[model samples]
Target: MMLSELSRFGLDPFLKMRHMQDDMNRLLSGLGTATAQAFPPINLWLGENSVVVTAELPGLSCDDVDVTVREDTLTLQGKREPKVEGENAAWHRRERAYGSFSRSVQLPFRVDPDQVQARFADGRLEIELQRPEADRPKKIQIKAA
Candidate 1:
């Protein structure tokens, strides 16, 4: 029987713990998991003519990140690895999660891909996308007739 099936007998918590442990191990080892979800939470802001995205990604470098901008979508992919001092080193209380993550968001309006800018500082990644000139709202004036 599948392990999850056995959980019907009040062993669900234990099985879940075991599964989480295994996934954590795979993450720390920089291995990919088909079920891996988005990590390093982010915030998105919409401006009059731009969209700003700020992602919190501590203990990671620019080289570990990849950002792509399409007409109306933004994709983020990266890996974060825990540092190991030595082979005998052990973590006392591991809290931070490490693993490959991907996050894609659909933008409210089309953006100029060539004008997108990205900056990484203090473990945070900020992306700025410019709205296309044609997409920006234009004000029209009615003349007396």
Candidate 2:
């Protein structure tokens, strides 16, 4: 009754391999796929006392996005749309990505929630968070007798 039920009759190795890869990619894509072609490609870097997050947010002005920091997690969420303003021509290929995306990442250290700062430049949103003062290391001085 099913096509797979007849695979034993004529199974092609190449087709089977391609199908397997496609299935796996579908599974991973559901779990927050991060690809270059995907909308809002995000990059996160952790430092000793800070975490820097950079996301590609094309067509978004400084006011279109918002950055929120809570506990040791950093969340980036935004939306984009495709707009047409000029006379349309025969469309051959359109590769620009537009959609709503959200990503939350855990930092290596507890940050100062009140002192967090976010800036957008050249279509990239950068978030800089300061670590808690109490969590930073201190230097001790030695005394001679």
Candidate 3:
């Protein structure tokens, strides 16, 4: 008998996406000393007139992170260190992500380079971009074909 990780959640589209993203992120960014190196998973969503990017960067402060945008690509780079200060006791097992990491994503469309906004809170970086109105698609309803 074999069981899969996704099978645990049954059938849920949102959950499936979340799980896959997590797996891919983890697989790509393995840990250095710890079990895993936190890379702050990211997700991009489209809005009516903009695209929002949210990243899960746990155990990281604004000072340790750097964000750079070039043309249509947004890059995030930083180092993650173990928060457990002063290692003591004979620990048999440790699992966490700690090391330098960077992630860059190319946006689908060129957005308002001036109207971009970013905020970090609760171990998450949220970036908002005001998309160009010209790039948005227009749909026309037809009563009869």
Candidate 4:
């Protein structure tokens, strides 16, 4: 019988071969190379009078990161430089990315630029933005006429 007919019997040899080929491709491609993204992944949260932003930036230190805040927007910029190894050393795999990335986010409220705070720890960056008093939510009470 032909290989195509084997699919009917739940024994697809071609699929196995394709999976093997993909594995080989990945193994060959991960040699002292880096993958890059247009922007690093980030998470944002809003509080009553504050907005928080967190970004994932593995393999980078504080010195390599920069944060900028505008009236209602925040920007994160960072660089991940590749490591230097011995001249005789050969890399078997290098999946981590090494390059510069910038991400900008528009906040829901106008922030007090003077009250912005940023901290980086354990490969993550956390930014705290304080909103202006005018933008904070206010409760209204109704009176009987």
Best by lDDT: 1
lDDT of 1 by residue, 46-91 (tens): 9999999999988888999999988899999988887768988877
Candidate 3: segments with Cα more than 4 A from true spot: 1-38, 133-145
Task: Determine which window of 10 residues in candidate 4 has minimal summed lDDT.
Answer: 30-39
**Higher-ranked by TM-score: 1 or 4:** 1
Please give, for residues 78-124, the per-residue lDDT of candidate 3 as tens digits.
Answer: 99987664656565676666788998889877777787898999889
Comparing 1 with 3 on lDDT, the higher-scoring candidate is: 1
TM-score against native, each model: 0.68, 0.61, 0.62, 0.67
Each model's lDDT: 0.87, 0.78, 0.79, 0.85
The full ranking of all candidates by lDDT, starting with the best, is 1, 4, 3, 2
Pairs clashing in candidate 3? Answer: 36-97, 37-97
**Model 4 bad stretches (over 4 Å):** 1-38
Candidate 1 worst ten-residue window by lDDT: 29-38
Query: 3 or 4, which is superior by TM-score?
Result: 4
Show model 2 residue runs off by greater than 4 Å: 1-39, 85-90, 137-145
Which model scores highest in TM-score?
1
Which residue pairs does candidate 2 place in steric collision? none
Root-mean-square deviation per candidate: 11.8, 11.6, 8.0, 10.3
Across residues 1-145, which tens digit of lDDT does each residue of candidate 2 receive? 4667567778655697899999999788778655655446778787877778788887898777767788788877777777664686666777776677677778877889898888898898888888998988788898998
Give candidate 1's error at residue 14 in angstroms.
Answer: 41
